[model samples]
Target chain A: MIPYAELLGLSVEPGETAPTYVMPFAVDVIGRPGFLHGGAIGGLLEMAAVGALKQALADEGAVRIKPINLTVDYMRGGRDKPTRARGTVTRLGTRVANVEAVAWQDEPDRPIAAARMNYLIVR
Target chain B: MSDSETPAGRAFDPRRLFGGRFGGHGGRLGIVYHDHGEDWAELALPYHPDLIGDPASGVLASGPILALMDMATSVGVWLKLDAFKGHATLDLRIDYLRPARPGRTVIGRGECYRITRSIAFVRGQAHDGDPNDPLAHVAGTFMAVEGYW
Candidate 1:
């Protein structure tokens, strides 16, 4: 189990194509008064991105991945609800991988937050 | 969350806001108040195994650092406003310069450079031991729910 995910009470549900990361609204994730913390949302998105990267690298036996950078855009304030995130690997190269993730509370079309990330992969 | 609290012109104390043992995620991650000024604030994130992103390296995850910086910059905005106006993070971008060394505390400092009627712009950096050698650089904005003075 990922320590940070466990800490946030984040769960991963395996889907047919990719895994979806879910973060429940709890006292540990509150930012202002009732909304979710941006960093918590960012963490869930990062976990989703990493999950997608791992799925993309299933063929490789053992590989290490390190995060290089991330840009998160908060479109809407996260209300007191379960937020779900999914990552899509845009470009997976030999040494670098680019991933994008979106997080939504109710509707998939209406994303509350989105992020693009770059990771360094050591084969 | 308005200019009401600014009536007395008392400064917003982030340390007081983060009082007690539990402050949600910030407290759970052991983020403590380090220092603050008029428009800048610094926070400390102690090393803990629970925050390790890579178990083999035992290095802290980028997420926790992001959280620290977020709170730091949020405090910076409040400090700059000199009031506790409610605000939400609009956007944030982080560049990881290097992974933090294992078993080391990280210090994150944030500064609010600009504040408009409804938005605040901030930038910050995180360092493990030395302020000169930073591990992460961050830039972001916050949207004041109430008008910012």
Candidate 2:
């Protein structure tokens, strides 16, 4: 696990193929008195995006992944609960990859936040 | 000294607000105040091994930087309004120009450019050392629960 992710108490749950990242609601991830910080959710989304990209690029050998940019939309206030996030690799090219991730607490259909990320592949 | 000399100082004191508590996530990240203006605020993130994203490169993760900018912009909104308005980040976009050098503190400066009745527009950049060469650029908006007025 990335040290920052570890510090945030983010863990991975194995899926059939890829993995879903989960962040526990804790003091380290809190922003306001009652709500989760925007950054923590953003971080979880980034981790999920990276995890999916890595899984997709597993056969490519030691290719390094670099983030180009990310846009995050906060749809709802994340309450005190374990938040889950998963990523979809929208496009994987020779030079770049696009990934999208969403975080939700109760229902996957209703997300608390969503992120679109682009990464540069260093081969 | 005078009224004009200290408008936000009277209401939204970032120093006193964040003071020793640091408040959860920011506290865990070891972020500290750097400076501020009437409509802008700067915060610094100290280097720590625990925050590294890429262990091979020892570079700090972008997550912490995003968090720093979020808080900085949040403070910028309060500074501009001269009070701490209840608001939440609606959306934020971050463009990574380059990775920060290992073992250096990162400085994020956020500015609130406009404030309407319900939204505050913000933009900022993060730099490890030279302000001219920024590591990331960010723009976003916050939705206020109460009218910003």
Candidate 3:
């Protein structure tokens, strides 16, 4: 299996309740001017959700989970600065898990994007 | 751009291409055939300030690029197959090599890599400079819809 960091191009860091992922916004990632592209943010959120699920399953002694569906809501435009993402496991059933994530810039109160993803565990 | 050029190549008037509403954004996001013939078709998008996410910072909106690429690839299939067969994108993946520089119009040239009865495979790149090392690369598959449009 590939290391989570290598697969997502970001690393999971310790947070208060759950872990946070840092995705640096490079100039190449920009969509229009100062705002990051929707596609790029979507990709980032997808990766973060998947990584969070992997970590959560590992804690429970599970091996693998495959992504089934993902839905992202663009709350506000993401600035060009490096952004941070946080993911939480809402529920981990026997064969499925529901996860939620939020991405923000400097302020945690205002999230640029939020997502809810469903994963199918491979037992 | 100018209001000239048709799909049939007779006087090439833009009004006649795709029933004169080709450039409007209501349906299919204003994709129109700039040039279409036996081998290839070209599509164009007008520059919009809203599409410009950063004025001081030079970059074209990524949504517009994706829309352009999606439409271009579909149009390529239509031209090659000689009909408007519907298709759904399976997975559209893009790698951003560089930011699209501001103040320049962007165009996508998509080619059908392979097409079967059920699927059409496509690979193309978006460029603002040197097409060899493009600013963006895209690879995707479109499942052919059964009904014709």
- Number of the top-ranking candidate, with lDDT as the measure: 2
Give the per-residue lDDT of model 2 (tens digit) for A10-96.
Answer: 889977546799999999989989899999899999999999999999888999999999999999999989999999999999999
* Model 1 agreement with the true structure over A6-110: per-residue lDDT tens digits: 888988899765699999999888777788888888999999999999999988989999899999999999898899999999999999999999999999999
Q: Write the per-residue lDDT of candidate 3 for residues A1-123, one digit (tens) a residue.
A: 222233224556775556777767655455445666555566566656765776776666746665554555666777757778877889989898998888888898898877777777878
**Clash numbers, per candidate:** 0, 0, 5
For candidate 3, write residues B18-76 as lDDT tens digits.
Answer: 57434222122344555554323445545545455344564554545665665566666
Name every residue pair that clashes in candidate 2.
none
> Model 3 segments beyond 4 Å from truth?
A1-123, B1-31, B37-39, B129-133, B147-149
User: lDDT (CA) for every model shown?
Assistant: 0.89, 0.91, 0.59
Any runs in candidate 1 off by more than 4 Å, and if so which? Answer: B1-10, B20-22
TM-score of 1: 0.93
Q: Which residue pairs show collisions in model 1?
A: none
Q: By TM-score, is 1 or 3 better?
A: 1
lDDT of 1 by residue, B23-82 (tens): 778878898878887898888899999998887778887899999999899999988887
Q: What class would a CAPRI assessor give candidate 2's docking?
A: high
lDDT score for residue B86 of model 1: 83
